[model samples]
Target: MEKNKTIKRAFIASLPVLAGYMVLGIGFGIMMRDKGFGVLWTAAMSLSIFSGTLQYVGVGLLAAPATMIQTAITSLIVNARYMFYSISMVKKYKGTGKYKPFLIFGLTDETYTILSGETPKDANENKYRFLVTTFNHIYWIIGGITGNLLGQIIPFSTRGIDFSMTAIFIASFTEEWIKKNNRKGAIIGVVTTLVCLLLFGEKWFLIPSMLIMTLLLSIKPKREAAK
Candidate 1:
């Protein structure tokens, strides 16, 4: 009974992620399909790699005749922000035992947001986190497969589909902004990103923006040391 209740709560908490991942994964699937890949490829990537942004970026990589080193460098640069997420999660996920591996593997932007939030009273925290991760992962896989199947049947322009990722992040950002009532982080991120975009141009702005944001957010304000 307790287990079932935990599952229920986790699912409810994960509903937002479900909505977001479905659209983003479908967008990814459609892009992959338009690039001449098939449903199997989509399913495999969604199941294994499981990073929506990376996978979307990967669609372009897979479409091109890039070498291994290029793919590695591109992937590292694109997913570098996760380093910060993992660092934050280190203590929370400690002692999670069997759940830790999947927790780490499934820790996408959506999953991270859900996990970082509060756990329910009298519920197993690790278990709740695991279930949320599992549910979001399944949603992503299902969405990708569904979109790939649809892509096989329907023909349309994949142009602008990639923007779904950006849209989802914006939604998450808004949610965090309202929930935390802290505007400093958001302001820093926005100002840093715009500055980088203007200085570096769209093609090269992401890495610098992320690096700058991370650096700024990590700096702790110093107060007079206890007199």
Candidate 2:
């Protein structure tokens, strides 16, 4: 009974992620398909890589004859913010035992938001966390496969297709903004991103902004708690 309820709660919490991942994963799939990769490649990337922004960036990398060192460096730089996110989750994930591996592997931005904010009270925290991660992961896999299948059947216009990634960011930011507590974080992110863009230019803004935002976000909660 508890497990069933936990699953239901996890599904509900994942509804928002379901929508986001479906669109973003499809965008990724369409891009990969247009690059001549098939559903297998799409599914493998979605399941294994699982980083939306990196996977989108990866389309270009996978097509080019890049060396392992370059790929490793690029991945490290792009997904470096995960280090900050993981720090907050240390206590929540401790002693998770059997579920720890998948929970760690499946910790996407959306999954983190749900597990951190919408965690259930009626069930074991670790179990609920596992279910939420599974739901979001499954959504991404299915969305990627569906998009690849559709891509095989229908051709997509090349123009403006890459903007889907931007669209995903906007949607996620908007969703976060609608919540009262998340408002400050959203503002911090936008301001940091824009300021970095102006200071560093488009090419270098992303890493600086992410680093600054992670610092602010990590510190902000502690400041608020002290007040």
Candidate 3:
């Protein structure tokens, strides 16, 4: 009974993510179709790459056919912040067995936010977390495949659909900002990103911005402690 209840709650919590992934995934699929990839290619990429922003970027990479080194560098730069996320989860996922790999694989920003905020009241905490993460991943995969299939049949323009990923990022940031009581951290993030965007432009600013923001935010707690 408790297990079922946990699953139910996890499912409900995942609804907003489901809606977002579907729209973004559909947009990606439309792009893939437009780029001449068939359903199999779309499904394979969706299943394998699985990182939402990276998957969209991967489409361009695939078209251009980057060397493995370049691909690795690109992936590392984009996903380096995930290392910090994994650090926080070290304790939460400590005792997970074979499940550890799957848990790590599915630890997106949204999954981490949802799971980290929830205190597990049930004995099957790992199961609950796993289900939630897996459920969200399946939502993206299903959405991507469905979108690719739809792209073959639908004839409308997909020009601005790529912006869906940007919308998702904004929504995620808004949610995080609302839940956080620490004004210092939020201010630092905004200021650092703005400055970096101006100095480095969109293409090269992300890593530096994130690094500086992390450094600044790390100091906030220490300063507050000293106060």
**How well is each residue in 34-136 modelled by candidate 3, as lDDT tens digits?**
7888778988877776787788888887888888898888898778767877887998899888789988988887777777665456637778788888888
State in Å the error of residue 54, model 2.
1.1
Which tens-of-lDDT digit does each residue in 138-227 have in candidate 1? 999998988877855546665665565566577777887888745787899899999999999987888788889878877774531222
lDDT of 2 by residue, 129-197 (tens): 888899889889888888877844545444554454455456656665676656877788889999999
Steric overlap count per candidate: 0, 0, 0
Better of 1 and 3 by lDDT: 1
Give the clashing pairs for model 1.
none
Each prediction's TM-score versus the true structure: 0.81, 0.78, 0.80
**Candidate 2: what lDDT?**
0.79
lDDT of each: 0.84, 0.79, 0.78
In candidate 3, the residue pairs with backbone N, CA or C atoms under 3 Å apart (3 or more residues apart, or in different chains) clash, namely none
- Summing lDDT over every window of 10 consecutive residues in candidate 3, give the lowest-scoring window: 160-169
Return the candidate ranking by TM-score, descending: 1, 3, 2
Report the C-alpha displacement of residue 55, candidate 3, in angstroms: 1.0
